[model samples]
Target: MPHTISGFSKLSKSEKIEWLLNTYFTDKDSARALVKQYWNTDDKLQKLHDEFIENTITNYYLPLGVAPNFLINKTIYTIPMAIEESSVVAAASKAAKFWLDRGGFKAEVLSTEKIGQVHFIYKGGFDKLEAFFKNVKPKLISDTASITKNMERRGGGILDIQLRNKSEDLPNYYQLHATFETLDAMGANFINTCLEQFATTFKNEALLFKDFTGDESNISIVMSILSNYVPQCLVRAEVSCKIEDLKSKDIPNPEEFAEKFKQAVSIAEVEPYRAVTHNKGIMNGIDAVVLATGNDFRAVEAGVHAYAAKDGTYSSLTHCSITDGIFKFWIVIPLALGTVGGLTSLHPLVKFSMEMLQKPTAKDLMKIVSVAGLAQNFGAVKSLTTTGIQEGHMKMHLMNILNQFEAADTEKVTLIEHFKTNIVTHSSVVEAITKIRESGNFK
Candidate 1:
């Protein structure tokens, strides 16, 4: 049968699903039922979700969990996390509690400057182009007045604009690099709007300049878009305590544990293979909170990873040090987040998540998110340097294994007890289940 169909997007939701089932499924009824099972019960809510994207099927869900006892900047918070990977929330919570009595976490917003660019190719002398940019800079700002009017009233608008020459990197290529203080919103649309206006005004003004020839005047606009590499939009989060105070059940010898932890971080700092995984652990915490709060996790991830590689070599976003008898672990990361636009007011659960954190501003949210990454890194490093990373992780993963095998309730209980004293692995769990069934001890 031919699978291609025109106007598929024009079909109604039911029709779309019917087409999909007929085209793709061997068991059409079971596939249809499974798709419907994930739909929202409320029609209005379902419609809203469907409109969020094109060809929307049922909503995909991630478990929303809360990790409590996050004492950041001397304020207590129970941070909400939306993630599917096992043990992330649990790890963050354990780290939070470990530092709760050690003066908790400290976070501060270092800066909040985002960036955008207007790219064009002009086959002309650099001197003439430089003079043209200097003359037309005011016009570029003035042309975007309408778009920046409301943002300026809110105390945030275009910060500055610069003309960058890139002839060496790419012949006849240059850029109008602009900076912005977006305040509480991620401001992608705002920045792109201003860049487009700047592009229009720059090209228009060039045509009128006597310093430009017709070819130069006809500057070809390559593109105008916001860059996701926000090095200036930075936040720092750290936790520090006396080395002697780092005592816990997991760290009987605080000195030995602290040294090993510092060495672990050091290895990641210079080794890209280890650094990638190390930063991923940090983002597991960062992305969860970013998602729960309805911010753009993809943008955040891109900016952060770029910043990690900014020093020319990909390195860890987190660091640890021991100085003056104190052990300090910290992370400096780039996060461009918003709390007043996009999904903040639209999604009910996002609103709930905002209120759960006492309604933080963008800066406040940045601080909170940085602390989460720091705490998560600390927990992971602590585990790795001490008892190893697999012990607790596999235990948390046992339930997933049990579910994959479709174990009954009583069988799960028995297996849960059995694994408490034994190591949990896929093969081990499968062997235990097989033996239990063969012994006729389970129904």
Candidate 2:
């Protein structure tokens, strides 16, 4: 059994690793060696990685790849994606190349509004709380002037503040709902600061309100924070071409492919089970780019999932249609991304990713990220409607499976050629490799 030690954080890096190994592993030498194997060789870089989070032991790596030929808003871009999944980058690239000749993708920002709230309880009459809120609203705004001054100068600051009463739903629950334009920053910290200030002023003023009687006078603030549900902060991306132009090598018949693709999206829109997996495919691309850029994928995932279920039922984020001679596929998702703040300037790879993107603004990043989701969905739907998803996905996954079997470079080359015609399954690959070894074919 492991015992908890006080002041564990005060230990030196080596000391901490020693304690962890002693506590957990029987073979401490080998375990310690395994941990240090991932550390950066450069002393300065390793230190930088260690300081990125608390109680850091060593680095965890994911492949950073680029998907080229993404034409958005008539501008060509090569998107950088950091992910461990086998087929995500390949799928996204295929989709981008497919649409590249078909007029590529078009994207536009619908809105840039974000939200925050302050929750408090007041066991008083609703009318009395409403009356007090109206009188205190201006003061709440004024008290946050210091916090909003810099943001205002940047042309992005508090947009509006409104009081909401939810006494019927939860006894004496009230919220100070606020909206903001964060410009080039994700603005969580900014919105949270303003909310905390608003909560302070609200509680301070409620104590002095003349209308308050009994429990109404004692307003207890529960918490103040920025919401991850920014429905209004939306971006739309789409690809459209003549129905005849949708024909490809795999999709020999444009009309059949288009019809099948439309039906697939429609099913996802109404079926919760399909919709959940469908949206996850879209996020495989979105989250990869979001992570590469050093933005918060968790917040993006939360906001987008909420937006999908906004109609009281979970549904697909991407939609498709074939009208007249045109076939179109598109998605509109809420993405609050930043190009200037947080890790964008600090992390080396993040800075490189911004440069690779031509240093887009928040709105531009929104368009790019939305296009990524749309392109990813296109690839998935196209696969689902045609040769099915596994053929391509498993082909990309073949290398990973090969590596797991401990195949040598020579064996990998032989298997790659052999599997070109044969179906690539784990069992089949393993059996073939074992037979080849027993035959002494390569040796």
Candidate 3:
């Protein structure tokens, strides 16, 4: 069935969402049925809902439009993100156009695997602990079956056991990062529960185990820590276009943009303070999609930030290079997400975002998330490189300002996009937009 309303702009926001719904589900019945299966909290779900609700200062998630012209792994995609930051969407859209002409970005992802650590801090020889894990992993893994019998029955349980000796830089911190194939589900509860039980074995082996993990290592053992971050997975995006395409368009200095982009990334890599915010700008495009999908945005944020500071110093997650006058961009992130779990089964908008993501596998989802971060980073770095941030950001920011002033949608967007392109002076753009607002149309 077609949308109950035709033209998208004429529909209410909820109606527009309903129209979007038509694109994904076979019918309204299917979509509505999912809501009942997922979000319906008659009694059992209500108790679960009550378990975690708090008053918070969260913003209304606005759709960040990352334009068409993106080709990933020979697949054309116009990825849409939900973000409010200025220039991020436009810049990514712009980069996509540049890449599209060059046969799009070539991408490859390894797997859709995520590691959940059940950290057991011990006051013993790190070597002894490492040897214990290496010697008894098979027994340990077999023992996992009884613990996750229910999960095993549900087709998800201990898939791999990985032991890593934490660097002496962090004392008594030997992390047991358990790899789980959470198949169509988020594995927080399953992974953490299995690890907590495994801790008892170490306690029985070495009496010091419980005490060391107890406090001296400052471990109270927080559970249900869901990880959207995985190990450093590889991702690549590249664009090759004729130099004339840029010069022919007469869109300011192209060479300058390349040089500045490199320098900005270098700066972001060197300074932790700068890297935090720079990476946050990258996440503005990423978290929006994560939010729109009802995935845990907070976990993604913490993981990305932690990954940024991984080297004892902070650095950019993306790296750039200029080869044969073709600018190439690459980024690696531990984006462990799934399309079959949590809100992917519940929310209507999550279904919409998932469609926009083009049916990403658990691995594919991480690849796309990395692309979003890199694409957004390229846009920001490009803007800062060729034109100061203001040239690219001011226009979208005006829309933010207009919305703050309660301007209507029609006048708000039109004036903002128009003034961005033709502004001679700030005073003129502001006055012209204000006058247009008074006249009820931008023209």
Top candidate, metric TM-score: 1
> Model 2 residue 434 lDDT?
89
Instruction: Compose the digit string of candidate 2's lDDT tens values, residues 273-298.
Output: 99999999999999999999999999
TM-score of each: 0.98, 0.97, 0.70
Candidate 2: regions farther than 4 A off: 441-443
Give the poorly placed runs of model 3, Cα more than 4 Å off.
1-61, 64-66, 110-113, 121-137, 146-175, 183-186, 204-229, 233-256, 407-443
C-alpha lDDT of residue 83 in model 3: 67
Scored by lDDT, model 2 comes in at: 0.92
The Cα RMSD of model 2 versus the native structure comes to: 1.5
Task: Please state every model's RMSD to the true fold in angstroms.
Answer: 1.3, 1.5, 11.2
For all candidates, what are the clash counts?
0, 0, 0
Name the weakest run of 10 consecutive residues (lDDT summed) in model 1.
434-443
How far does residue 390 in candidate 1 sit from its true spot (Å)?
Answer: 0.9
Better model by lDDT: candidate 1 vs candidate 2: 1
lDDT of 2 at 370: 92
lDDT of 1 at 415: 90
Winner of 1 and 3 under TM-score: 1
Per-model CA lDDT versus the true structure: 0.94, 0.92, 0.64
